[model samples]
Target: MAPGSSAFKEVVESHPKQMNHKTLKMKAESGTVKTSMSLAEKHSIHGVHELLQCPTCAGSMYPPIHQCPNGHTLCANCKIVHKCCPTCRFELGNIRCLALEKVAESMELPCRYQSLGCQDLFPYYDKAKHEKHCPFRPYTCPYASSECCVTGDIPFLVAHLKEDHSVDMHDGCTFNHRYVKSNPHEVENATWMLTVFNCFGRQFCLHFEAFLLGTAPAYMAFVRFMGEDSDARKFNYTLEVGAFGRKLMWQGVPRSIRDSHRKVRDSQDGLIIPRNLALYFSAGSGQELKLRVTGRIWKV
Candidate 1:
């Protein structure tokens, strides 16, 4: 019978009938307490999670989360390469734990990234998967592919971008940046400039590009957060373009870094200026193109 069940309670009641009545009652009560306490222990973070953790790898046991012949548990991750239990040195293999699996199912646990601001609760089976893409999770170096392996929060990422990528950093949430495409007539489509804006302790990238939209030469500009789209929606940006008393404005939530600036631009989700309009903003007699763009970002 499951511990603390009515049947188990009856078994405890059957104990020591010949002993002193008071002592006998005390024994039954102690047994009741022990079994009742097991429920709390079985579901506690410090208790069950610790028990589930592999002795060697310290990973949580999720039933074929593995076990040794003598009943010590190990996570599935630690089961391979070691033939014996690390705790008891007993031969380890094929030990099914149907009872504990039921207990694991009964408990909801926080993601491993809980310390990083994730409040999500999940069963053991879903915790790791949710954490992998959790927005609150610390970001890896945006430049990870180049082997510049550093990781931290958003502020740390901005600092890394400045120190390592040597990316241009502009001050303030509001900006009046002048983008110069010097050769407006160039047939090639391209990204002209990228500026990093620091505000609200977060980093946003301003992308300026010159491209052809359906055979119409144009320029597109937009903002994207250094994090994921889910995070980007927490804030919004406004882009403004125009010089001679007329202005075109686009305002929207910043896309996540996962969405390439080109994707945002091609989505027509930002400010777009056609060739004629772009040239009018150009200084130096239209031979060069310059647009004095003004914009601001604020938390939504």
Candidate 2:
């Protein structure tokens, strides 16, 4: 499509298939995108549904997206694997479904985080990306893998840890606690215990585990916030591990969610102690490791 005076002008030139859509793009370009709820008063939802589905993947197709020259539609990802439409086999040029998109622009879409109790209504085109890292998305208990695959929001997870797991909760950002991996000989990459701390009106997860970072029996402890990564930037946390003055400190903006706790340990985003240092801390008294980990979180 050629670049037009305004964003919607380009839409007008590219997507004028129906009478209503002839200048709809131009109007929308001039800041007149309507809501599906508003349009529902006049247009039928069925009209929007008929063209919203991608024939190849059956997923919802957003507008200004791709379609075949014959007008058979597919989501952008599905169209990547082939140059021709699956149904009509028409050469997949850069033809766009302008009218379909115009309708889509008006639709009130639900958040993908709806299952987690997020009720935000976004435009059809913005919902998927918005919900991926939405703060209200369902979260697993940060403690460990549990038979209780029960999901909850941040507050629910906080209560679950406090009551069910008996996790210790501290206020403010600074913490001076001793995290003990009593069974370092267990040799399984398992979490010993997880604690929670609150600071900057936000909650952070403190994960303590006995794992093998690189074949040496090691202990790792890290912190993660209970929100999206964007929210994580509101505060930064620092964890220091030391006993004999040889301290290892890590300061980073916590992740909203722990994609992989192991990945954080592997990347050494926290205070990681190998057998040598761990043994020094233990001082051959036993097969356990006691790390005096102190941390503080502050607003940015």
Number of the predicted model whose lDDT against the real structure is largest:
1
25 in model 1: Cα distance from truth in Å? 52
Q: Which portions of model 2 miss their true places by more than 4 Å? A: 1-43, 54-58, 62-123, 133-136, 146-149, 181-183
Scored by Cα lDDT, where does model 2 land?
A: 0.64
What are the TM-scores, per candidate, against the unseen true structure? 0.56, 0.64
lDDT of 2 by residue, 1-300 (tens): 111101110000111112231110001111213433455643655566656888788788865578787777788888788888898987888887777788887766655565555555666667667666556667776666545566677778899878886676766557776655555566566445666776555678877667776677777777887765666777777877766557778888787554555555667777677767766765557666566767777768
Clashes (N, CA, C under 3 Å) per candidate: 0, 1
List, residue by residue over 33-107, the lDDT tens digit for candidate 1.
111234464366557667666788866666566778887877776777788889899888788767777777766
User: lDDT value for candidate 1?
Assistant: 0.65
Worst 10 residues of 1 by lDDT: 23-32
lDDT (C-alpha) at residue 252 in model 1: 88
